[model samples]
Target: MNQSDEVEITLQVCDPKIIAGLNKFIVYTIKGMDKNGQFDIQRRFSDFKTIRSFLLTKWPGCYIPPVPPRKAFGNLEQQFIDERRLMLEDFLKKIATLKYLWYSEEFQVFLKTPGEIEKALLSVPKITNEEIINKYQDAFSDLSGREINREIIQKINDFKAYIQKISPMVQNFKQIAKNIAEAKSSFQASLIHFITVFIPEYENNVLLEYVEQKERLIFANLIQNEDAQGLINQYCDLLKEPKFQELYQEVRKEGKQLKAFLETFAEREKYESQKANAESRQKELQLELQEVLAGKTTIRTLFSKGKKEDHITKLQQQIADVGKEIESYQFICDILTVLVGYVEIDKFKMEKQFQYYNMIKNIISYEINLSKIAEEFWSKVLKSENMQQQQ
Candidate 1:
């Protein structure tokens, strides 16, 4: 391996800090390291966008991996910042592995002195839409020969056929990830509602009242129980107060909000991880196809009394295996959807039925407590009377 091959580039995204300017924005310090040295560069998401554009212009037809979405809202959250940081790191790593890209003067300069990025960017004019159209049009005219066109067309068609097999699988995987994430969100919300709202309501309206009734009946026959009765009345009055109800509602709302936010944040992390793997594989296949079309890589020929036929057979088997794996994933996703639906239904029913049972239990428990206290008081009175008669 040459010196260039020995050069290993690594990128680390540091914690985000607020950029000082007229309009303060959050930016992260991307720490880049190679055999040469280490450099710390602070950049916003737009900087990454510019870099992607530069790459596309420099390496046309080469697959560029997807970047973090340029979201206009909620970008300030620490979790959002962290997720984007990871994506940016991945983007840098991919670029570093490309020989022509990593060693470019522009890339080296950007890494060494980020302050001069604007100057570097200005040197490469954005490709005009008209120019792009004209280039393709001229290319087609150059390939006007029927034989040449037929061969190129056949190669393109074969490439498309192979890609078509992988495309659906990639699409299905993304869809499954999306549905699972949404379902997880819904489940989290339902669970929070059950814990914060339903459970609290049951405790306050049912348990408190049941316990209060027992105390009330026990003090009914005691002449000197004014202090105890007053304490019980105070507790009942507090339960009825609007301020107390408002506070309870606020707490419940906050609990749900916090739980939902935390859970959704975690879901985003998991979704991004799954998405990165899919996108990487998709881009790999796309780059391979592009290389084949561009004549950079030799195309496999069939039945030529060599390893070409074996190579093609191996590729065909891999595609078949991927198709089977996709089918299994689809089945699993379907089952998960059904299960999530069932859980939602059960959760709703539980909420409704629990409230009813809660009310019934409160009433039954209060009556039972009162009856026990009354029975004890009467038993004492009867015993005193019987003792007087015997004396």
Candidate 2:
């Protein structure tokens, strides 16, 4: 949160517990530290979803990190749950880098709140869309405080179309990764099934232990591959449901409101007569007040000189009230314009860089792990052959 602050988060412990007859869930042991010191918290998958939902609602214009997709318990529940934990850690670590979000009340509740966070998150003050705009501007005034101009609005419009175009491509890639992961899982299952049948069939079983060791290494490769690719898919989901799109919608919504607001000013049928009458009366009062100050109107104009003065005072109040009303309308226009045209869409551009960087890193690490698995498997195979020849 500050220059001296350090943060670390990892979700390595997931204890699967069953409750109420077949309703099973994963409870993750989230451990982390901050400038305050190290702390540990336990949260469920629902809890992760809860925190993400809170952030999404409260910070419409900012990036709210993605959570793993909700899926029913399957044969690969443990592996999937483990993969989800890793992804959740990535989510938190990404959030920690953004200072505004790191110190956000909702996130702080998630990181340090003593008990269940959902209720506490409710206690976190609700911010309106206008307020959200102000909050982001306060945080990134140098970058995003400018009024939304027609040029930037057009750029955002282009970006909206671009995201729509790219989202399906990302979704298709996620599907492919998912298919590969599932196929590997099935392959691992077949290998386990074969090992059970094959190992006991050997009477001497001289090759038994070596086969088992290779099996374990092969299993590790498949599991780790699934783990890594699972994250890639999660990242794809993030790209599909991006914060830029949400912020764009916020701007568009405000633009629509502004349009309707201007329409109110131009509604000749409904407001034109009233506006004309108010303007005419204001002019009349101004002229009359000027004449009163100049002593051009009679003191007996309103039964007494004091009543005549009171009339002048009332005219002054009416003009002031009209001016205040005009200022209020202008203020609303200013706020709306600032939101609809503010900020470059570079937030997502930067996020794309981050998402791709980390996604590629996971991919490279997964490949390296596969190489190690291969090396270990081959070494075991050759050593087993040597032992058999020596015997």
Per-residue alpha-carbon lDDT of candidate 1 for residues 143-220, written as tens digits (9 for 90 to 100): 232342354434434533544455555455545545654564465456445533665466556655865642332223
Q: What would the TM-score be for candidate 2 when compared with the true structure?
A: 0.53
TM-score leader: 2
All candidates: CA RMSD in angstroms?
Answer: 21.7, 12.4
lDDT of 2 by residue, 128-212 (tens): 4346546755776665446556786576456556655655565555556556655655655554444334333441254446555
What candidate 2 gets wrong by more than 4 Å, as runs, is 1-23, 128-134, 144-147, 183-347, 350-391
TM-scores of all candidate predictions against the true structure:
0.41, 0.53
